[model samples]
Target: MRTIIGWAVLLLATAWVGAVEIKRPVDMGFVPLRAVSYEEAVELCTPLLSKDGKLTYAKIKNLLVIHDYPENIEAVKKLLAQIDEDPVNVRVDIFMDQAAQEKSSSFDVNLRNVRVEHRDGHTRVDGGIGISAGQGSREMSGSTNPFIMAGNGRPARIWVGETVADPVWVYEYGMGQGWWKQELVNRDLGVSLWVLPRVLPNDLVEIEVYPRVTARGSTPLSVDVKELGTKVVVQNGATMPLGGLDSSRRDAYRRILGVGSVFNGSNLSISVRPTIMRMPERLRQEKARQDQPPEKH
Candidate 1:
């Protein structure tokens, strides 16, 4: 009986030691984020967390509070360091051109005894037809160049346009009398460009260009909006060209009992030039020194 009791106490002691050895103390780490947001860091660190790990954000100071194992904390730190990069600068130039075409001259003549024949997928006409040349010319319309700067995956936007007021007329019927009301509606017409630029380690830039144009529609009270967006990858210091936005203008005049029209049209092309501006090594070292906490006296 005494031997059994002694064995039971010894087993209990061994079990307690094994339990203590299996458990590990949770460690706390404070990490600073520069390029990426705190929320993004948490999202990235959540998957690598242990069962007892916790993450908190210090918004005022823009720091990350991590409570996890030492190895896990180190892993999170390394992951955040990989994505911390300098800002990207993009310059967008929009070019527009207008061309005017008018009916300069016309020739007409009566033709009789004309014969037409088709053979082997070809048409042959044995009659003389009137021919006239139309005059068409193009001129430089207008252009705009805008620059924007943003961090790694952030977006920057710029708007270049104008606001137009459209008049609306309404008729109301009163008791035995009719009245007309005139209201002015405001609209915006122009281009809105949103650019997202990402600089890779290999000196390549991935740009997302979203160009929206607002113009007048066919009807008086209607508005038209077109979104021309595309993704382009280009080398640093190179320009990427984007097209497909077209516009036109027309004016009419009354000439003593006749009306004439002057037509003008234009095509818009955009080119984006992205430049990666990295912080100098000396400046980076100075910034790091400034970010360090002051030593206690």
Candidate 2:
């Protein structure tokens, strides 16, 4: 009976997606989901985005600042101007292609109180985030911090690129019934996902999701935590300041929040979450590099 019900919900979700190009100014909602066990995450995933068949991506430009640059003061002022000018279709040139690249999909939107501080001759950035939904586990330790400018603070700059993680879907066909007398049992992935419906077109929706997998002692297990990501819906004209907490390099203080990266684990389990990297920033940086005179060294 449970299996039949699950299939019903999944079908309904599929019916909800509108088979059309996403139009703007979109009535977008950000959802961030977290799950400690695989089942928990998948619970909410079954029926996601079914009501609104249309989807769209918001263009987010990262602002990396080097305070020591001659144009440091002007840059911040100008970046703010760019963000202010359009609010949407923001324009800022990221200097390194490696600095920003885009793969697709994003999740974090509750960024606030961002700032960089110097500690022990290394640039240390500190910030905090509050999720308004889902009781996500803090046990899955990974880099949720922003990508630092230089990781070491040298050539010091607060670099911004693109980063986003959005959940796709969840549907399962039972292979067979649980045996009444099973000799061995194991749960490699334990997770669940929660979905909060939108009451309005412009609602602040956040979904926090993660994977929970475990193998009993002496039980060899290998599995992949597939497509574990985030979703966020923010009000109009909302911007979140960014800073990160991960060592990009030695003697450097930087956090990389871009997509297309992995959260590798030693327990024969790997989590693939997309990091945000930018496109224009990479191209713009390349142009400047080419224009620079050949290295004197």
Candidate 3:
């Protein structure tokens, strides 16, 4: 009887360890700089960001261009015509509720009236530069046991399975690489479903989640997908576990499981942040980012 009890405790401990839980979510706050003026702010200071601040910078710049600075290029030209211009200040206060607490989050940066101060014979470019990493809102969906259909970070057709699937999911979470997924319980094995883009044929290049993430076992954990109802046989380690699956995302997970089910399964559809994605899609996102205007709150 003692042996039976001990084994039960051991199994329970294993499941508990493997269960997903949210570690500290991606730090989606303002990365405050030395507060340089618009003119002195060289090249947007893209490197100082937590991760690649290119896309985040693009978004911020778009905000400035549209409502503050060159958005009104004609107005800017007019200002240049004047010598000692009036002080124009565009206060940045972006506010956004915690949308995708697990995956990512963002806030609204308010675009105040441009403060046109002609300092040292030059009309300073209105406001200084500030960046907020992981700065975007997400209406997240679903929760599951990391039971994602292995494919193009999208819904996999039930009947087609891996044949029509996109092999792997590539997610680059270097923003919080150091302390993102801290080990919760001693034997905690919780999983978060991360669907990455297919850079090549089967690109499963994953940078370590936490330094000790490998303690879980392997990068693409091969598990049974039959639990999610797919003839695909097994999960192709496409979606990796990040943290514990909470109640908030249960709805979205249902659709992902249902999506492939011909009878009743929710389709998994997600908007990939091009700025944080790989090539092909990255290129497409860059074009879209350039062609698009500043997003309205």
Candidate 4:
């Protein structure tokens, strides 16, 4: 009996020593999830989990279970606190200016049947017929400032173009009598602007802009398209210009009207301004006051 008691005391001491040597995982009790979904919270916390980390969720109750080392759990809590807030709303303002080459009524002057004579250091000039002819250009210029609002990380599109019917001719092969008929098909000719905005930290905005222009080609079946895509970062409520899309054509008139050359230009310029919705200071103060507990009598 004495030996048995001594052995039991030794075993108990060993067990206590083993328990002290082992470290238990900390359980950050179930926290109520508000703004973000359970799945999103899990995704955000997965990367911060250590080797022995464990996580679970109660979807019906909207509760998040996090179990890990004390430091990792704290980090996850901070992350959840940061991202579980109201969604951010962003508004994008787009300003577009399109100008096409405008040619004034061009005219040509010609001198014919001119006679000149010089006798005894005296110069004499005869009358000549002067002819003038002109042709006008058919181009237009316009400017538009269109503003659109969209949620952050979404795409907004604006189409400024026209649809026209195209003519198509078909021949009948089965019938002996040949028939000639024209069918009208529709075609779209215009410009489309797509803007995507993302709000980042530090009061900055990142924008993705895509501008496409389509026009009629030389042939009935041909079409011309011009596209430009770029990404830029700017401060909130600041405007940034889109570049690399300007074109000009020069028509040279050597002997007509003593004019050197005619400049015809088709220019496009775009400016983008992004504004993010933020909580007002006054409303925030009121909310803080309301969140406070009632005073005890």
What C-alpha lDDT do the candidate models reach, one value each?
0.66, 0.30, 0.31, 0.68
Stretch of 10 with least lDDT, candidate 3: 88-97
Tens digits of per-residue lDDT for model 3, 1-297: 999999999999887766532232232222111123333222433233323222132335322221222223333323333432122221111111122323346654655555777778987667554545554433544322321222232222212122222244444477656323433222323322333322223333221111111122335443322121111111223333333333334332433333222212223332211111223656646655664553436
For each of the candidates, the C-alpha root-mean-square deviation to the true structure, in angstroms, is: 18.8, 30.0, 35.3, 17.5
- Model 2 bad stretches (over 4 Å): 1-180, 183-186, 189-202, 209-233, 236-297
Backbone clash count, each prediction separately: 0, 67, 43, 0
Instruction: For model 3, state the Cα shift of residue 43 in Å.
Output: 79
Which candidate number would show the highest TM-score if scored against the true structure? 1
Q: Provide TM-scores for the models.
A: 0.55, 0.16, 0.15, 0.43
Models sorted by TM-score, best on top: 1, 4, 2, 3
Backbone clashes in candidate 3 total 43
Two-way lDDT contest, 1 vs 3, winner = 1
Q: Which ten residues in a row have the lowest lDDT in candidate 1?
A: 249-258
Residues 1-297 of candidate 1 have per-residue lDDT tens digits of 999999999999999998885587887777766777878888888987887788988776566878899988988888877876433454433332233343355454656568999999999888766555455443434444556776657887666678989998889999999999999989888766667887776888888867666878998779999765668887888887754433321111011112122323333345667777777889878766654533435
As a TM-score, model 4 comes out at 0.43
TM-score pick, better of 2 and 4:
4
Ranking by lDDT: 4, 1, 3, 2
Per-residue error for 296 in candidate 1, Å, reads: 9.7
Cα lDDT tens digits, model 4, 18-108, are 8774556465645556556777788888899787787898766566877778778888888888877644666777665555666566556
lDDT tens string, model 2, 1-297? 999999999887776653333331223222111111223322423333233223222213122212222233343334333432211111111111122222343354586787889888999767977555433322222322322221110122233322223233344445774333323333333222222212123333222222222223343333333223233433323432212212222111112223223322211111112122223657656644543433323
